[model samples]
Structure formats: structure tokens, C-alpha cells
Target: MDVDLPYRLELISDLPGHDERAWQVAWNPTKPLLASCSADKSVRMYSYRPSDHGSKSLAFSHMGTIPTGHTKTVRSIAWAPSGKTLATGSFDSNVGIWEREDVSDSEDAGETAGDWECMTLLEGHETECKSVGYSSSGTLLASCSRDKTVWIWEVKPDADFECMGVLMEHSQDVKCVAWHPSEEILASASYDDTIKLYIDDPSEDWFCFSTLSGHKSTVWSLSWSPQGSYLASSSDDLTIRIWKRVEEHEWKSVLELRGHERSIYSISWGVGKGASENLGWLTTTGGDGKINVWEITEMQHTKDPLSATLIARISGAHDVNDVNSVSWCPRLEHPDLLATAGDDGSVKVWRVVPS
Candidate 1:
């Protein structure tokens, strides 16, 4: 993890496609493939090669084009770890998984001239599909909707899929859902003001393992610690809460990260090695135009979290714009980098310099 040094936002490149907002941007875990989605009803992948020379064109490698299907707006996008498939959720209440195929491969690894086809259109969620994610193993895909339920699907080895289960517990729209890195346990945050953790079962009895309560307002974002021991959530309450599973199903609030004065939009864990350190560090963005980095400490993780310290923070980040999403780059061999998007219809990459 980087030391307590404030990150300097370097304007690597600006992608302006969405007229209203760039809803989500996903970076492929394999190469430097970057995919961005927007309300303009388009998803474009960018390949930025440091070795390439040019101002307008060579700076970006536009890979497979994602066909926009939703009627209203494209809200979310997630790339499979294999970097071959992408899952997208939209305001149209539809979830589409686009699989990339090799059409005319010129040569080499970096050269990919292929087209994307929407192989699967999942139909179950009743309202706007806000969030979606591929499981740790990429075999399971989970999505949350405005209908207050979490749906999990089992992707077969034969490239087809089946509806595994629907987790019903939250009282309001399920805003966010995340899966543990090594286990099948799922955590979901909702506008219902609570976060519920669920475990899968063959008996169809999906019960809550723990109910996390701390946010004074709607919880919009939830993330599992890469190792699965800690959980982090951001809310309209203007604060981020951290929870830990001390025992089996018994979880406790460990940290209340308060830096953003406005509603927090998204949260993501730092990339580390094992389940313990995969997300040992954390970062977040908010409507206050600020970006903050936090170190999940052992002392603040013991019930009294107010004593925790802020590691790094960048104020007036997107100036007068609401920061929509924060993400730790998955090509995590270089673990100190992060990618962020905002309502200003721009994406910026940050290098968390270790001091």
C-alpha cells in the first residue's frame, strides 16, 4: 500500500462520449484494456500504450465495441477476469453479457480487431438494474435491482447459464452487490438503509448471516475486503462504514470513515496479494468533489472506529462535479494505481505514490 501521501491526479487522457454522465468504467485484469459506459447508450474500450506515439489517435487503443441495448441509459459494466466477456446493467431493467470473438486477428497479443455480440440477455430484475459483478471464479454472476432483491446465476462450463437463486431480504431497492474473493458469501447494500450478507444454499433457504447497520442514510455502495474478512460501505449519509466478521455469522462495525461531507457515490478496495490483502487498502469518491484513501487498521477495526486516521485525501477533485465511481485497477501487479470517473463525463487515473 502507498504511504500517507496525497495522490496527484494526472490527466492521462480524456474520453468524452456521454453527454450527461459516464456511469461506469471497467479495466480489464489481463491487459491495459479499459472499458467505459455511459448514458449516451455506448460502451467503448480504450487501449493506451505508453510506447505508442501520437496526440489524437495513437494514445488510445479502441478495442471491441460494446453494442448498447438498453432503451433508457447504460448504468453499469463489469469485465470478467478472463477479459473476454463483459456484463452490463442499465436503466432499461435489462442485464446483457457481451462476449468478444476474434474476427480478423492481424497478429500479436496487443492486436485485437474483434466485434462483441450480446450472447446472453438475463431477464429477472423488475426495475432498473443498478449493479452487476462476476464472481471470484467468474462462474457466478450476481445483479441487484430496484426491486429489493439480489439475483445470482450459475454460468455453466458449456458457456450457457442457469438461474441459481434470488436473495430476498432488503426492504428497498438493492443498490449494490459484491461477492467475497474466496467464498460464495454475498453482501448487498440497499436504499433500505441496511446492508445484508447472504450465503448460497441448495435447499433454497438463503438467510441473512449478518445485518450491518450504521449509515444514517441510504447505503449506495458495498465492497468486500479482498480477503473476505472486512467489509466497506459508502452512503448518502456522507460517511463510509467498515465491518468485520469476528466470528462466523456475527459481524461488527469497526470503522466509520468520515471525510466526505456529501453523499458518497462509490467505493473500491486496493489490490493486494491474498484474500487478506486483496483489498487491505481502500479508496472512495463523493458528491463533495473529494477523493480519500484509507488504511484499514487493526486498532480501528476493534469496535471503536472513530479513532482511525485518514491516510490520504484529494479535495476539489472533479471541481463542481459529483464523483460517480472509484476503482482499483485489476492489472494489479502495480498495486498503487486507481481509476476514477465522474459526472463531468471524464475519467482520470491516479498513481498512489508510496512515500
Candidate 2:
């Protein structure tokens, strides 16, 4: 721990519910709820509120658990932009759409009280589904699989889905899929050490518009900056790469960040509590059991390279266990809050505080 660091990660609480390695954690964009999925084949939900003990702290309570009913591990979970629906992708080769049955106080300020039911089961991937995500407008959903393909589905009324495109562009297992923060464009990372960008063609189907090749090893995750001008990718090569949209259809790597000694599994970019609106914060963690928070400032001029500064870092964040996922809370009121999942089967909440 460097005492001189400008920021430090303050322990908030450990959410104890998942009984197996937790794969991912997601913050509800429109609610005070947090969700985690694990190898236990279950999804855990927790509700959080500002702590009475301190203004910078949050208190979390276990709300409920969804069995998910997946025959294998629930690999990934994503909340729809509306925060009313959750999509779960599993090693069972299926994607499940879930909704709460109890509408009472559905608009309440606390945790949603209801029985979560799988509204639809989407099956097309021939192998394990690795990741799932929803577009900015909640109109489109994307899923990637070990089948080396990405699937785009249209979110229809009545829990129905229509397959818009089946992208077979990746030569190896697709590890993760993410949509641009405010666009219909989708990006998929693969074990082939590349990231592919896709967009819908009005006259045809969704197609890959760009293939970003640079990482020497598997590309594990992708996150778009809050403003959508940049994309950050973590890789098995133990580095995070930043790509800039230099042209309408072209993107080039502008920066490479190296700190982790092992594979970087997950990276998340969020609007930070910085003084400038263009300053976005990126959090990343992985096999090294460490968490790194970097502050990225958008370039003032088009030709200037993006500036990145490591504002805080904590090693052994999971106590000798691999930190599988890290997510920034989406609520603007609590921009410094973060939630992380680990192989130790625990979800921990943290807050970035000035040292």
C-alpha cells in the first residue's frame, strides 16, 4: 500500500451469499441493487443504502437469490438498460431472460421484492455462452459463446426475441461482448487475441466493421468510456489497451497500460467523481488478485494522446484469490463506489477515498 497515493480503496462490506467462485458482478443502472453470478449456478441480489455511520459508506443487505436453473455454471450476467430485466448466460449453452413477478412497489426505492422468473430461454449457441449484454436503448441484446460466434437479438414485446444476426467472425472462443455506452455498435473479445466491432446494416444484417488486432494473447474483456469515444480492453497478456476512434469506422490503439503481472480478466469504465466531466475512471482486476484504478482524461486536441494516470491500486484484493470481476456503481450520486467478485466466493464493496 503506497501511502502517498492520491486515492485509496476503503473496505465497505463483504457480501456473503454465493457458495462458489463468483464470476461477475453488475450494478443496476437505474436502481440501488447489485447482482452477482457464480459457478454455484445461482445469482445473488443485494440492496444497498447510504450508511448511517458515515457519509462515504454504504450498507448492503442480501435481498434474494435466483437459482437460475442453469445445468452448468452461470458465466455472465447483465442488467438491461431499463434495469427491469436481467440476462444470464451460462455454460449450459443457453441465455435466460428474467423478470420479477411481483409488481407491488416495483417503483420503490429499495430492493425489488418479487419472485424472479425466467421469461424466455434463448438457445442457438452450440457451446457455452460466455457473455451477454444489452444495448444503450434496451432494444438490442448481444451474446457470445465458446462456439466462436456472437449473436444479436432484437428485444421484442412480451418477452419475445428475434435473432437479428449470427456473427461467425471470431476464429476461437468468444470471451466477452459489450455494447457502446450510447450507440448500437457492439464489441466482442475473443481467445484469438482480437476484438471485433459490429454494427447493423440497414439493408442487411449486423456485420463486423472493424477488427482490432494487437494483443499478443487472449482478449478477455471490453468497456467503453462514459462518452463512447474510447474503448478499453484487458487481456491475458497482462496489459490494458486503449483504442481511440480516429475515424468514423476506424479505431487505433493509442495507449497500452501495464501493471498486472498476470492475466487481466475484467475492466470497467465509469464517470468518475473527478473535477472534469471528461475524466473517466477505469477499474481492472484479474488473476493477480489485485485491483487497479486509473484516471483517464480525454484529449484536449484530436492529435493529443489520451492521458492515463494510476490513481490507486490494492494488491491481493481478494486475499490470495483471483479477482474475477470489478464493476463501478452506475449511480451518479455514488460515483466512487465499486463492487468486486472473487474466486473466494465473496463479493466486496469498496469506495475510493482521498488519502
Candidate 3:
């Protein structure tokens, strides 16, 4: 089988905002907006739209900052599928929900702007909250923490949220929680070196359907494929593992990508216009301060177990700092675009151009 080789991911620009480590970055699902959280105890949003004047280079302008009510570091952020709401998890052991409000002024000639307001605070975790995520339908929210538990919240009408259930399966700290791309299933990674999958059935309720246990160390982050069939996890074991669903409630590791010189902190899968039968492309960042693009061919990965290959790697991606997170632009117009954050307190954007 022929493959696309030697993909080039060129750095477009560095977006500086935070005074400390930027822990996570997320792209809005339906808008040209990007959100990031940092250890500085603040949240920042940017307005990003590629120029149509024939230049492929990208630029992001600082839109505004939200002085989040949290007293500690904001570790993770996720935007609702409708791009109308944002959720942030913090070390203060609270989750803040932000809603976008339209701003208008007569002196500005009736032009409109966006103002994000802290709508409500969800508090229940015993310790630091590490990650927060919203389901594809935006009706459910998930958060995991150092408390070794994952909490699912039901988004009710009139700015009300209730804890639907709590998952306490991981013996160690839960690092991240990600919802499936299409389904209501949820996956959480933990320091117990395992990934647990959960589903909500009307009769069975929310229960762990399967446990993916193969990583030798802490699983730091997870990213599900666009079709919700495959999941990629990065770990302190210094590798990125790809798990493909075999049975309806079972999954197995099909490939282990071992190239990062240090702990792999985050991984993100690209999104495009078509339903890719393969894994398409994935980007991973780690303590080594490098970003690697892996081209995956899962057509026979269920039986082959060696279907992914590294196509491009950018060294010193965050300049000697631990790169914390990596995410691909979700917009259909710029699927090849990527975003990365690091301990150096900067967010860099790149274009993964295929050769």
C-alpha cells in the first residue's frame, strides 16, 4: 500500500499570552476561536481567521481575557459543540462555566462584540480538578481530577447543572477525560496506567464498559478518532498507543508509537471534510519539546499491530520547555492547522502541509 510520505508542518507564528505555563488549548467546534488556560490562573481567548489575500501563513489576534474566579491554576478547557459555552477545570477544585454574551455600544456604531461571562461554578471534587470536557451534543460535561474520580454533569436548562454520576474506578489520579466524537461514550486516562471507557445506557446507567491496560506508566491525555472508532493515548511511558475498538464494548491496542525522547504529554487527531477510514493524521507533544506527526493506516491494524509511521517531527517546538498540549484546528477550512502549548508560556500554531 502506498502512503503519503514526508509531510511538512511549518510553524506559522507564536501566540504569547500567559505569564506561566499554558496547560491546555482547545479550538472552537464551529467558530474561528481558540481558547487556552494557564497556570497563571487566567483564561484567554483569541480570534483566529486565516487571511484570504493569498497568504497561507496564519495569525491570531488577542480577543480578550477572562479573570476566572478560580484561585488556582486552570488546567484544562473545552468548548461546547455549539461554540456558545466554555468549561474550565482548575486546581482550585472547581469547574467554571462561561457563556458568550453579545456586547454592543452606541459609540462603536452598533458593531457587536463578544463578552464571556462566568455563568456558574460547579464544585464537588475533593482535590485539584485536572481536566474538563463536554460531550458532542453539549448536553453532558465530564471532569476528572487528582481525586481519582471522574464526574459527569448533566447540563440542564436555565443555567443549571447537576452531577449525573461519578466514576471511581481508577486507583490513582485521573489525568484527563474525553468524550467520544459522535457517541455519548466517555474515556478517561489515569496514573494507574490504564484507560477506562464508560457508556450511559438507559437501563444500565453509566458504567465502565472496558478497560484498556497496556501503558507502563501514567496516561496523560487521550484523543478519539473523528469517527469515534479509534482512541489514541499518550503516556509518561514515553509512547503514544493507538487503541481500536474490536467489539462493541471492547478495545485493544493496535499500535504503539515510540519516538518521543521523553514523556508524551498530549496527542490530537486531525479533522477534515471526509470520513477517513484510516486514522488520518495525529500530532503528539511531550517533555522532549518536539512535535511529531504520525500518518496512520488502520485498514489492517486490527491484525497487523504496526500500522502507524512518523511522517514529520519538529524539534525544539516549545524551546526547551515541556510541551503540555497539542490540538488540531477543528474547522473544515483549516483541518491541517495545529495548536500547541508549553511550559514556556506560549502557544504556537502550525500548518501540517502534506507533500
Candidate 4:
């Protein structure tokens, strides 16, 4: 495979001005909108359309900006499974869901020209919500906070906006939580230097089915493979580890990926990860000003790979700015695009220029 990348710098879009660094950006799966929330105490949406068939993503236009009711910084943002709603968690220890209500042509058409409003505000976590995400089915919203716990909330069958359950498991602040694409299990990484697994089983209490240990520092982020059988985690220890389950009784770490020179801050699994025919890749960004993609190959988990193949190295994307988070677009209709946020005050979009 041969391709030439100029390593060029291009500005895709200028988002709304933030009073401080933005923490996260999420792409809507069912529309052409991108949502970002930041220290400015606001969440805004920008509309983007390809100027031409093969044009690089530039020329994004601001559509609408919503001033959230929270007085603190927004920590994380997640688009609902249907893309009709968005979830945001804040440093104020509150999570809010925003839903789009289509304005009919006959019902005061000129009054408002937007498709979204805050539908609900959820309160349970006692400290700042560190992470929030929608499950694969979107019926559940999982949130973790500085209070050292994660809660799983189920939407009510009758009430359009209602919270149902709370999961109390981890003994340390849960840094991140990820839902498996096809299973009911959820994986979370914590500052306690351990990973916990939770499955929604009715007969038993919401407890850690297993605790994975190996990281030498705080765990920052976790992502599940597309098959929902494996988990990838990155840490301030400067390592990324892959974990895969064997049968239903046990799980094993298959490989440890290493390359970044600074503390690893964020990571994402490739959309096609965990397939028999494809080499599963994990992309990580850190304070070192480098983005490394690790190619994983497993003969079997029983015999872990001694190392991972470094498939791609990108620098200057965030550089000294310290990228706060990175997310691979959900494995849906488009799999080539990825979004990242940082102290640089921008969300950059990248596409894999196939080799």
C-alpha cells in the first residue's frame, strides 16, 4: 500500500468561542450536525456539508447555540442512538438530555428555527461527572463521576424522560465508561488503577464481575470492540491494553500497546476492530504531541502478542495543546471519520486516506 500524505495543516471549522478549552465534541449519527460543549457554559451545534464531492471538510457553518442551565464546565457529550437527542455531563454534577422537536410549518414557523431543547436533567452522582455515554440500544445512559461511582439509568416506559437505576460498584473515581456494541455488559476504567466489568443481571447485585489489573497509573479511557467481546483501555501509565473474554467465565489481556512519550490521555478502537479478518487498531493521543495507531494481532489470548504493530504516527494534530478526548465515529453508515477535542480550542476531523 502506497500513498503520499503532505502532512498539511488545514482549518476545517471555527467553532463557537469558548471562555475556556472545550472538553468534547460529538457527531450526530443521523444528521449533518456536530455538537460541542465547553467551559463557556454553552453547548452549540454547527451544520456541515461537503462543499463538493471530494472536498476536504472545510466551510462548516454555525447553526444554533444553546446556553445550558449548568454554571460549570461541560465534561462530556454523547449523541443518542437515534441521533434525535444528545446527552451532556457537566462539572456541576448534572447530566442533561437535549431532544429535537421539529417545528411545524403552520405552528409559529418564524418564532424558532431549531430542532433541539433540553428534555431532562438527571441528578445522582455526588461529584463532577467525568464521563457519559449512551448504550448501543440508547435506552440506557451510563455516567461516571469524581464520586468514584458509575450509574446506569433506564428510560421509563411511560415517562418520556425518567431515570430508573443506579449502579454503585467502583471504589475510586471512574474515569470512563464504555458500552459494548452488541452486549449488555459495560466496562469502566478508574483512577484506582483497575478496570471493572458490569453486566445487567437481575438476580445479582450490580457488582464487578471481574477486575482487570496491570496499569501502573490512572486509567483514562476505555473502548469496546465492534464485536462487543473485547475492551481497549489507555492510561496515564503510557500504555494501552487489550482485553478479550474467553467463554463467559473469564477474560484475559491479549496485548499491551506502547509508543507515546507522555501520559496517554485518550484512546479509541477502530470501527472494524475485533474482526477475525481485520487487524484491530487502537488510536491514542497523549501529552507527547503524538498520535499512534497500534495494530493488534492475536494468535490467541492464551498466548498474548509480545507487542503491537505501530501502523500510523501523526503529530502536530494537538501538539502542546493536550488533546482532551478522541472518539471514533460510531460504527454506523460512515466508518472513515474521527473527531478529536483539545486545549487548542478546536475539534478536528480526520479521514483515513486509504493506502
Candidate 5:
């Protein structure tokens, strides 16, 4: 736990265009692409190419943009694991499913290429949908909203989706929902200051398997370790809590990371070089307009006063605006890269290379 940072974080480039705050930025799981949503009611996509060896930044070119279709702010965007579809949640209280039409097969390949079509809209959420995520298997999508509910949808062929379950378990606004990296288990964070884990039963019904409660204020986001053994949650309580599965249907708080002076908005776990078992690094963004890199060790979790060490920090990471979200590029080609969105309406790309 006491070592120099193995990686050096360098701000590479910024993508700016949104007229309002950018709420979320997500990296495509299978492609060199990034998608971002904003309060300006649009979703933008950028394709990344590695820069020259000695260049200080990565290269990301604007591919295209989905029209301003959402009547209100677009809060979240998620790409299916297959890289063929996208789901976006908005303040308009609706969810949009977008698919790329196969335009390359046309006789005139130049005219119809790169066509993205809105396949369908899911309109069941009664309030602003805060987040949307597809399960790792790509067969299910989960969405949570201010209406205090989480909805699971079954993905059918040809963009057909069926609402499988409506989980009305949270007592306050449901802020974010995330699927486990390797399982169908779903986790939702809420304004009630709790995170609930759910799984589908043999009857095809989703049920709460466990509730993680420690944050003293609203739980804003949840992220699972790449190995699927631990869960991390950020909260308005200004702390990030790590939970370990101790037994079947049970989880225990293993570490409480306190550093940010204000509400912690987002957290993401990434693969690190020489990552020990249940030990690695993570990045956190918050209302304080700072980004922090933390090192978590499983050995520390076994000791009293378990905690993670802050390895590095960037003050004013977003030019005095809250960093709303941070995501590590999951593809193998760019494992050391991170993308962040901020209230300043920009998406930044940062490279974390071994120092």
C-alpha cells in the first residue's frame, strides 16, 4: 500500500460542444468509441485512434451525433455489450433504443453508410430516468428513475424489448443502476442512502438479494470490481464505501475511503498492472471538482480500520465544475485510459501510463 503510483495520469485532450452540462461519458466495451450525453438533450459519439508514439494526447474524431430528440436533459447513455445498440435515459421520462441500420450492404455504399436509427422508445418510467445499463450478457437492460423504481427489460431481436419487472423497493429517488460485470445481478443506488442488489429467480422474477447501507446521505453511483467480488459506491456523504460479498446473499463493508470535501458523484474500477487478488486501483469524481486515484488492497480489508490510500489527486480537474462522471476504457487496446464528463460541458481523455 505504500509505493509510488505505478501510473502517471496525464490530461490528453478535451471534447467540447454541448451547450449545457455533460452528465455521463461511457466507453464502448468492444470498440474504440466513446459516447456522451448532456443537458443539451443530445448524445454524441467519438471514435478514438492512438496518436503517434511521442504525442502527448490521444486522437478522437467526432463520428456523428444523434439529433436533439429528447425533450429534456439526457442523463445517461449505455451501449450494449455487442456494440450494436445504445440505450439513453432522459429527463423527459423516456428511454430510447438506437440501432445502426446496415447501410453498407446497399448498392450505393456511400449514401447509406453509418446510419443510426431510433428503433423504439420505452415509455413506462413515470419520472426522469436517471441511469440505464445493459447486463454483461447483453440480453437485459436495467433502468432506474426518480420515481423510486428500477425496471428490468428483456432485449428481443430487432429492437423489441419487454418490461420484465418493476422493482419498487427504494423509498426515495433511485439515482443509478448498474449490472454486475459477470452476472445478471443488478445493483441500484438511491437517494435513500442505500444500495440494493437484485437477481432473477427461477420464476423469471427479480428480487432484492441484499441491501448495502452505510452511506449517511444519498448514494449517487455504484461500480463493481472487474472480478465481480466487490462493489463500490459513491455518495453525497462524501465517502466511497467498498462492499465485499461475505456469504450467499450477504455483503460486508470492507473499506470506507474519505477524501473528497463534497459529495462523491462517480467511481470506476479498472484493471491495473500487477493487480493483486481483490486489490487494484480506482478513480473517483465529485462535487468538489476534483478527481482522485485510489489504491485498494485486500490485505488492508482484513485489518482494523480498513481503508484505501489516496495515491494521486487532481485539484480543479474540471475547471471549478463538478466532474459528473468518470469511466475507464475497458477494451484491451486502451486499458490505461480514462474519460471524464463535467458540468463545464466537456469530455476529457486522460492517459495513465506507468511512471
Candidate 6:
């Protein structure tokens, strides 16, 4: 351990209930629950509480397990802004919508937790669905697939979804889809080494407004800055590119971050401790088994639009197992906390502590 580092990752708990490789982990936006999906075709939920008053550490306990009912591996999971619904993307070429039914009796005077049920299953993708995401307003859901397409769905009441549009502009497999923090803009990364941005035109249908090309290899994941002014993408080229929105529908690469030795699988940008300034932190992990945290600062009155400083690095984060996913806790009060899923089928909670 390097004491001179500005920050360090302190392990809080290792959740080892998944029977196969854990693909993704997501934190609830309005609740204490953390969800992880695995190649075992199951989704595991965990709830956390602070160890003590104003404590930085959290005690996590397994809440429940959902045997997703997908015939293939569950590749990705996402939570809606309200934390009331969960979306699961599976290799079975389908997406599953899950929600907990309130079974608490009104006469009991105490609210009882309910079991998670697969409320709806969305089918369309010809191949595996790689990622799923909900818009900031929770009115729409977007999913991408290995079929080289991105599907947008209008989220209606009563678990009903209508297909808004099917985008087929990508030449290769679509790896990830991310919605802007406060806007309806959507970005999708692909195995074709490019990222495409889409917006629904009021007079017309949804269309790709811009295509961003820079990565020399597959673009694996995408994350938007806390304010949605910038987008960060990780790629098989072993580098992360930060794209800044210059014009209304135009984005250009502002900076490239290099540290990981292998393909970066996941990247998450969040308001981590620096929320006051509106400059968020970016966290990344990948096949090199390392986890990195960078403090992103916006530059004013300079030619450069932004800068990134590597504040913390954890090598062999999963003990030689490739880290598949990394997600920051969405709650503003717990900005220093993050969760990661690994190839070892384990989900771990960590807190960023000052050295």
C-alpha cells in the first residue's frame, strides 16, 4: 500500500453468492440496494447500511436472488431512476424487466419486503443483448445487442413497452448503451470501434446525429459525466477517451487516458466527493485486473477543455480475475462508495479513503 497516494480503495465486503462469472453490477439511485448479474443466469441483490452514524464504512447483506429465467447468461443489469424497476439483458437474446410486488398487508402496520418477480420480458434482438439503460426521466429504455442494432422503447404504464425505433447504423456488434444524465440523448458504443449519438427529433423519428470514431479497436463501454457535458469511453485499444460536447449535436475527443495494460471493460463517471464543483470522478477497470480512479477537472480559459489526474490505482483488484464491471453509488451522500463485479463470480464493495 502506498501511503503517499491521495486516495486508496478500502474493501468493505466481498459478496460471493454468484455461481458463475459476474457480468455487471448496478447501484440503486434512490435506495440502499445493489444488484449484480452473472453468467449463471441469476441476479443477486444486496442491501447496505452504514456501520455507525456518519460512518464511511457500510455493512452489506444479501437481500435476495432472482433466477432471472433466462436460458443464457445475464450480460447486463440497470436500474431505473426511481429504483422501482430493474432491466436485465441476457445472452438469450431477450431483455427482462423485474420489479418487487408489494405484498405487505395493510393491517400489519409494518411494511414487509416483497419477492422480486419478472414482470415483463422484451424480445426482439436476433442475438445476445449486451446492455440496457433507462433514460433520465425514466420514460424510455434503450437496449443494444450483438445483432448490430440498438432498440429504443417507450416505457408505458403497467409494464408495457412500445418499440420507439430500431437503430441499425452500427456496422458491428453494439456493446453498450448509455443515456445522458439529464437529457434524452443516447450514446451507443460498438465493436466497430466507433460511438454513435442519437436523439429523437420531434418532427421526425430517432436518428443518429453524430458518429464518433477514434478508438483503434472495439469500444467496450460508455459513461457520461455527472452533468452530461462529457462522455468517456473505454476500448479494446487499452485506452479511455473523453469526448466533450462542443456544438449542440457534435462531440469531439478532448483527452485520452492511458493506464490499463489490457482492454478496459467498464468505466463509470460519478459525482464522487467533488460534486460541489460539478467536476465528477471517473473510475475504470478491465481485463488487466486493475481498478483506477481519476479526478476529472474542467479547464477554463485554456485550449484544453479538461484534464484527468490519476488519484488511486488498485492492481489485481480481483486477485488476477478480470474485473467485468465497476459502478459508483448514485446517492450523493455516499459518493465515495463503489461496487465491482469480477470474473471470479464475486461482487465487492469498496470505499475511497484518504491516504
Highest TM-score: give the candidate number: 2
Candidate 4, residues 112-220: lDDT per residue as tens digits? 4565678888888898998898888888778999898888888655326445446666677888888878677778899998888887668755566888999988999
lDDT of 3 by residue, 1-355 (tens): 0134567668876889899999999988776678889999888887765556657665677778888979999999999887778899999999999986774323221124667789999999999999999998999999999999999999998679988899999999999999999899999999999999999878766889899999999999999988888999999999899898888888989788888889999999885322366567888999999888887775543667547767778888888899999999988778788899999889888887665
Q: Residue 193 of candidate 1: its Cα lDDT?
A: 92
- The best-first sequence of candidates by TM-score reads 2, 6, 3, 5, 1, 4
Error of 4 at 90 (Å): 0.7
Please give the distance, in angstroms, between residue 68's alpha carbon in candidate 5 and its true position after superposition.
4.4
- Number of clashing pairs per prediction, in order: 2, 0, 0, 0, 0, 0
- Deviation of model 2 at 210, angstroms: 0.4
**Pairs with steric clashes in candidate 4:** none
Candidate 3's TM-score:
0.93
Instruction: State the C-alpha lDDT per candidate.
Output: 0.76, 0.93, 0.86, 0.72, 0.85, 0.92
TM-score result, candidate 1: 0.88
Q: How many Å off is the CA of 137 in candidate 4?
A: 1.1
Clashing pairs in 3: none
TM-score of each: 0.88, 0.97, 0.93, 0.86, 0.92, 0.96
Tens-digit lDDT track of model 1 for 128-241: 999998888898898999988889888876468788888888999998888887787888999989999888656765567788888888998887876778888999998888
Better of 1 and 3 by TM-score: 3
Cα TM-score of candidate 4:
0.86
Worst 10 residues of 6 by lDDT: 103-112
State the lDDT at 151 in candidate 6.
100
Q: What TM-score does candidate 6 get on C-alpha atoms?
A: 0.96
On TM-score, the stronger of 4 and 6 is 6
Better candidate by lDDT, 1 or 4: 1
Off by over 4 Å in 5: 1-7, 53-57, 103-113, 274-278, 300-307
RMSD of 4: 4.2
Please estimate how well model 3 matches the true structure, expressed as its whole-model Cα lDDT.
Answer: 0.86
